[model samples]
Target: MEYFQHEWLERNLNWFEGVSKLIPSTNNALESFNRVIKDENTLRERLPLSRVVVVLINTWSLQYTANAKTVHAVPTLNLGLWTKAYQWATEKKKKIVSHVNSEGYVYFIPAGQSNEVTDLEETLNASFSTFEEFKTVAFSIWTTTIPNDSNKWIEGTCNCPGFFKKLICKHVVGIAIRLKYANPPAEAKSVPIGAKRRRGRPSKARQALLVQ
Candidate 1:
């Protein structure tokens, strides 16, 4: 038992946490493909060699052909991450509330909305407000950054869709902004998420044709 425990400790989660930041060690594309094979083809039971060949060619071959043209890309660019982080820092930084767990290795930062017209502006033009860290059930899901870092924003992880897709997000970056760990570059204008810069000129308003 002691030997097993020693082996497990040597290969503990901290070893893989760093790996996850680089590349998901256990939850990679190949692992997902293997899971599909086990679940759909074998059903956790050993199949005959002939059946295995049938599953691979008939099922996976078509899937590979279909996705051959598919291009995998990170939606959030590095600049975009910083830009959105700056926006979040401007708008939602006031809402950031943190609580340190007993371990203190990681902390929570949650935000919420306000219906008040003044609060909706979300600018630091207002006076600075003090934030306290403690245990409380004050906020709900989606409003919180799922950052699992002690100090480094570069290593922080967020549960946001943006983060899930890109492994980085405004929430985590906003936390970094609050912590003063890193500053967004000067070119990172505080543009809201989903706002796109239109190419060329806007079309002139057209009058409806009158029945003649």
Candidate 2:
């Protein structure tokens, strides 16, 4: 309780708040793209600025062209980017439903209303911890208003570390699943079939040989 009150609660309490505008809450797409860059020699090794620019331009061009094609083929659910989030939310649904069956009740409150103290046991059982130093702080599932819109409650929030850091948590996922089915995001624009690909960087070995 002390660990939660002092450290975990304070830092992650509002992580899940105000996520209505987001589809998955997590930036997995961006992370995956970064991982691809890291896996390639582009970012792992120190290269000349010119080479770096070439590598980035090439990569971005390929991705942009591929994304354009994908969007054209399928125009729903952010071009299937939300697939993982949907799966995650589905799994959490089972757990939450089971928990509700056993526990009898799980409190659901509006996003900003969590400040009002209440019975802690009534909250969702979404607390988790990787370190022994801190006590696990259970998250309370709450409904959040969509960003730039006050009349809609399409967003959800939780007080979990996952939600705080990556903007994803079981509680938030559960809400997302329902919201996504009810209303999907707008379709992405497709790339032209004959889009031009970026040119590759000059070979350093060839440049060195030419100089010699």
Candidate 3:
């Protein structure tokens, strides 16, 4: 990190004057940005990907200096995971069962591929005006699964047709937004243990096969 700072200093000799005015002469501005990035990811360990570093760079650059309300970069979590899943599923000749949980976790179930397992800790969360209202919104979003029927098994499995195409599907994003205000479980539960459940394949099997 220090090496990078020194390298940055060397490269910015010409821009030094303007850079100083924009940030500071302390040169610790990058460190502060890095700290913010760490907090955003909730990571306690070293980053596993150079892409993560790029994300941090972009996110901090925007938040600290760009003065933009929201950075329109790739989603730091879902999009990365989704791309990986799509790649794996394609390579191994498999499919993924994706759905939004009541708690707003986007569950990704790989059919015949992907060495990765479903992470109980999902990136999604819910939102609302108040905590109680948030919980209500969470419940509503979870309950609003497609087919417009009270089919728990069908919904849990994400068998609905319009799910994948709608990037920020109403039911899914709604629950996720609600989760922002809801209290989290004090003790994390282990992987859900119950009867094995399957909710059939996508109608877009051809589309799934073409994903590369």
**Which number leads on lDDT?**
1
Alpha-carbon TM-score of each model against the true structure: 0.39, 0.33, 0.17
Q: In candidate 1, what are the lDDT values of residues 42-115, reduced to their tens digit? A: 89889899999998899778877998435444333466567767776666334443455543324333434432
**Candidate 2 segments whose C-alpha is farther than 4 A from its true place:** 1-35, 41-44, 66-154, 175-212
Clashes of each: 0, 1, 9
Task: For model 1, state the Cα shift of residue 21 in Å.
Answer: 8.9
lDDT of each: 0.54, 0.43, 0.37
Which has the better TM-score: candidate 2, or candidate 3? 2
What local lDDT score does residue 172 receive in model 1, on the 0 to 100 scale? Answer: 70
What would the per-residue lDDT of candidate 2 be over residues 1-212, giving only the tens digit for each residue? 65765575686665544434334556787897678777874757868889978987887778788884244221133333243344434432222321232322233532322444344354443344443322323233342222222222223334544444544444443354554533322221122222322244323353345654
Q: How accurate is candidate 1 locally (lDDT)?
A: 0.54
Best by TM-score: 1
- Taking the tens digit of each residue's C-alpha lDDT, what string does model 3 give over 1-212? 44544565465455533222212334474796577667775354576688787876777667667676455332222432233323322343323334554533353433222433343234125323445664343322212232222322123223222243322232332233233321222221111222222333313333455666
- The segments of candidate 3 whose C-alpha lies over 4 angstroms from its true place after superposition are 1-23, 51-212
Clashing pairs in 1: none
lDDT, candidate 3, at 181: 23
